[model samples]
Every structure is written in structure tokens, then in C-alpha cells.
Target: MARVQFENIYKRFGKVEVVHDVSFDIKDKEFMVLVGPSGCGKSTCLRMVAGLEEPSEGQIYIGDRMVNGVDPKDRDIAMVFQNYALYPHMTVFDNMAFGLKLRHFPKAQIQKRVEEAAATLGLENLLKRKPKELSGGQRQRVALGRAIVREAQVFLMDEPLSNLDAKLRVETRANIIKLHQSIQTTTIYVTHDQVEAMTMGDRIAVLNGGVIQQLGTPQELYDRPSNMFVAGFIGTPGMNFFPGAKVVAEGDTTKIVLDGMGQVEVPADYAKIARDAAGKELTFGIRPSHLEDAALVGEDSQRSSIDGTVDVVENLGNELQVYLTAGGKNIIATLDSRSRVVAGNKVKLYVENDRMHLFDTATGEAFF
Candidate 1:
């Protein structure tokens, strides 16, 4: 296990710089994921640490040693590429043993390492077969096994499961989690999918436009996001935003009336936050999961419910996704699986007062 650190990291492609002053630390044996949309410089950051790409500025360290100028192999890390990169003609066993053989490990030692790695990845039964004989998931496991045989200090995976089918991707994700628990090796994974990052990482770093927007444990980032981008990016179905809303004070309670969306009473603690927004434009945020069918929720102090006409219904087996247009505002809610809500019908929807997130429209920063 090793601690990985990036110090004010920067990358450049000719005169057009990509990554800008990026910095973060991955604790020893932690499963940390860097995630964002395409061209966000996440894969580029991983490549720099792997020594496959040089840092335009700053330094990268693995454990206590600076590895800025170290060769990729000498960095004592194993990388599982997205493409799998398996040799077409080589048997799975040879592919797993290739690195050790190149390093001139004794035949018995190489066999032991490969066999153990094969078993760990459940590839033992396919060792004699070539990659062409295997399924996409099986081939991916072979790629993982190849890295496992190295027993490197750190592991770097760059969207290795992207090529697998949805079901296989989920299974492989679970397998990777179990593998990490058993091996306890430090890993830095990069992906553009937020679902993978949330499920697989102990902590996630959300990146956008070549800079990290937020970094924290999955729950921390979800519950207490630092900014609008993160709040919107980290959640499934994303967070709902009503721009140019007005905050109006009603007696002791602080309230914000959304555009075409009804007024939501704010908590007393947040009253001061909304007080400064007399005539200024404000953005109100609410997560999809927090928006519930009024019949399913209480008129309690938790939230305020308003009426909406169902626009669409997405039945996702275990749960129902109800899209509605209320107060002239469009929103989605994950309702109970047995929900009888249908399109064109009207139903009451609750927007929790305490769960309301207010942001300055211009800066996109959450109002504390």
C-alpha cells in the first residue's frame, strides 16, 4: 500500500494547457476515483502519474519518493487499460505471466503468481484459452489478472469496465471492490461515469474543465456538496435547479418562491442566507430523490408539498420515475415502486424545506 499525491499538477499539449493547478492526495490503500465528463483531464491526470505523460508543471509522488521523472515500470504501479490490451494469440496464462517472465522470474515463481492471480480474478478455468475464446467480461478479467501478477504497490485503472455490458459492468465492479478489500492495495481509478465513481470509490474527486470541483467520501459529496456543479453532477437524475427565483420573507420563516414552482419555506438556520436576496436573482436546488409524492409524504415540518400534473412515468422495476409539471416547473421524482401515478393526472409533490439548496445564480456557489 502506498499514498499517492499530486502537487499543483498541470499538463499542456503544445501551447494549449489542459489540466490547471490540480492537487489532491489519495491515502494509503484507499479506493479513490477521479470522475468527470469527457476531455475533463481525468485520464490525462492518471497518465501523468503513470509516467506515460509528463507533467507540464508540478510533481507526482508514490509513497515517499518523487516519481516525476521515473519510468512507468519503475513507478511500481500496475495499470489496467480500458481496451484490455490482451494479445490475440497468447493464452490467458502467458498473458498473465508475461511481465514476470520479462523480469526473468523463476518459472515456478511465475507459475505461482499467475495461478494465484487467475484464481483471484476467477480466470483459472480460462487460463488455457486465447482471448478470442472469451467473453468481454472474461477478457477484462484477464487484463486485471495481468496487473495482479505484478503485485505492484499501486494500481491505476482507467475506465477498465467501460467495454463490458451493463450487467457485467456491475458484476465486475463488485469483484473489483472485493479484490481491493482482500489485496488492500492503493488504487486510483478514473472514469467519466458518476455511477461507477459513487459505487466503487471509497472517496470520489469530481473534476470539470481540467480542475477538481469537489473531493470527499461518497456520502459527503452527496449530502454536503460544495458547489452547484457537484450537487448537480453527483446525484442520479441530477439535482433540479430553478434559476432566477425570488426569496420572500413570510413572518419568522424564510421562503423562496421558485419560477412557476411554489414557495418553499426555508429552515431558520438558512433564513439569514435568503435574507440577503431581496431583489437579487437566486437559484433553488432540490434533488430528485427528495421530491416525493405528496400522498407518500407528511405535511410535517420536513418539507412543503405542492400540486403537479404527471407528464411521464418511467417504471424502473423496483421503483417508479414520475415526471411532473407543477407550478409551471418540470421535475422528476423517484416514487415508491408500487406507485399508481400516471401521465396527465394531477398529484401533490413535496419539496422539503430543510433539503432546499439555495445558490447565487451568478457564481453558482451554495448560499451557506
Candidate 2:
């Protein structure tokens, strides 16, 4: 395993720049995920590391070597693409051993390596089967096995689980994590799915508009987003944003006034942050999970409650996602599965004050 570093990397196609001064370090044996929406340049960034694409400027390092001019084959990196690029005519064993064979490795060593990789990936019984004869999951495993047999210092996977069914994707995801753990190969994964990035990456780099918006652990990105875009993009159901809200001070306390919903008291620390911005427009953000049914909360709970008309109620077995419309603003609350709320019902929802996020109306930067 080796450390991978991108220093002020920029990529451009003609006059249109797709990547802008992106920089980050992937430690030895660390699983780093590059995640964003389509056209965000995540795949381009990964391609640069694999020597498939050259950066317009800046330098890239694999371990202690500068690999800017190195050929892809000589980079000592193995890449697993989105499509399982296996040879249909070759058996799994031959597919896995093709690289070693091309490099003129000994017959015994190739056999040993292929067998070891097959055993590691639980493909011992399917070594004789062709790619066309295997299931999607199996084919994907064969592709991964092909990479594993190389035993390269780094592994670059680009949406390797995108083609699998939902259940199969979950299974394959677990398998990939296990493989990384067992082998401890430095891995850089590219995915557009936030859930996959959150679950699989040791540290995630969130990109947008050809820029690195945030880089941190999943928990850090989820709990303390740097800006409105990061806050809204990293969560399931996204964050409910209420615009044009004002901060009002009552005595020594501060409160945020939601037009249709009642006032929500700010915590002391937040009150200090909001005091100078009183009467100015600000954006209010609250995650669905931080909102709960007020009726179910303890009486002594310090949460601030607001009233809204339920627009929809989705029961997700273990939890209920309640969509509400208050004062022309839409909000969603994720509550217990036992919640009895229904469409058109007027319900009281409680917000955890300390968990609320405030952003500048114009700049979209978080206030606290």
C-alpha cells in the first residue's frame, strides 16, 4: 500500500475547465471516496491518479514517486471500472491470470496467485466458468479478483457496484470493504451515490461544480457541514431549508421566526451568533432526523415545537417520514414508525434547537 497525493490538480478540456485546483492526500491503506453528482469531475480526478488522464497542471505522487509521465501499466495501480471488463472467451482463472501471463510470470506462480485470489473472493468453484456464464455479482467478483491477483500498491474502483441489483450491491459493498480490510490496499473509489460514499469511505471528498466542496469523515460532513450546499447534499431526504427567516431578540434570548410556524428559541451560544444579525434575512436548516412528533416527546423536553399541516406520510417500516407545509415552506420530519400522522392532519413537531443550522442568506455559509 502507498500514499497518493494530488497537489493543486487542474483538468481542462479545451476552454471549459472541469477540475479546478483540487488537492488532497490519501494515506497508505486508506479508503478515500470521491463523490459528487454527474459532471463534477470525480471520475476525471480518479483517472488522473490511475495515469489514464493527465492533469492540466500540478503534480501527482504515488508513494514516493512522481508519476506524472508514467504509463498507466507502469503506475503500479490496478483499476476496476464500472463495467466488468472480463474476457468472455476466457475462464475465470485465465481472466485473473492474464496480467501475470503477459508479464511472463512462472506457470506455478500464476496458478498460486489466481487460486489465492479466487479463495479470497470465494470464487474457488467458478474458476472454470466464462464471464458470459456467470451472474452479474460473480462477474464483478471476477473483475475484482483480476485486480486482486495483481497485488498492486493501490486500487482504483469507479462505481464498481453500480450495475448490481440493490441487494447484490449491498452484498458486494460489504465484500469490497472486507477485501480492503484483509489486503489493506490503498483504495480510491469514485461514486455519485452519497449513501455508498458515506458507508464505504474512511474519508469522503465531496465535489461540486468542479471543486472540492468538503473533505472529511462521513460523520464530520454530516454533523458539521461547512456550507449550505454541503449541508443539503450529504443527508438522506436532504435538509429542509427555510429562506427569508429573521432572527429576533427577546430580552437576553434570541429566537428565529418561521412565518407560518411559531418562533424557535436559539441556544445561548447561537443567540450570541444571531444577536448582531437580528432583523436580517437568514436561512434555517434542520435535518429530518432532528425533527420528531411533539406528542411523543417528554413533557420536560427542551425542544421547540411548531405546528404544520401534514402533506404526506410515508411509513418506512422502522421510521415514518412526515412531510409538512408550514407558512409556504416545506419540511420533512423523520419520526418513529408508530407515528399515526396522516395527510391533511395538523400536527405538532418538535425541533432540537442545538441541532439547527443557520446559514447566511446571501453567501450560504453556515452561522454556527
User: lDDT of each model, Cα atoms only?
Assistant: 0.87, 0.90
Q: Backbone clashes per model, in order? A: 1, 0
**TM-score for each of the candidates:** 0.95, 0.96
Query: Worst lDDT window (10 residues) for model 2?
Result: 298-307
Where does model 1 exceed 4 Å of error?
277-280, 301-303, 337-340
Q: Residue by residue across 1-368, what tens digits does model 1's lDDT show?
A: 79999999999999988999999999999999999999999999999989999999998999999999899989999999898789899999999999999999999999999999988889889999999999988988899999999999999999999988899999999999999998989999999999999999999999999999989999988887888999889989988887877888877877787655567888888888689866666888888788777776666524466567999999999888988886677878888776688899997777766787888888788784
Residue pairs clashing in model 2 are: none
- Which lDDT value does model 2 have at 64? 95
Lowest lDDT 10-mer window, candidate 1? 297-306
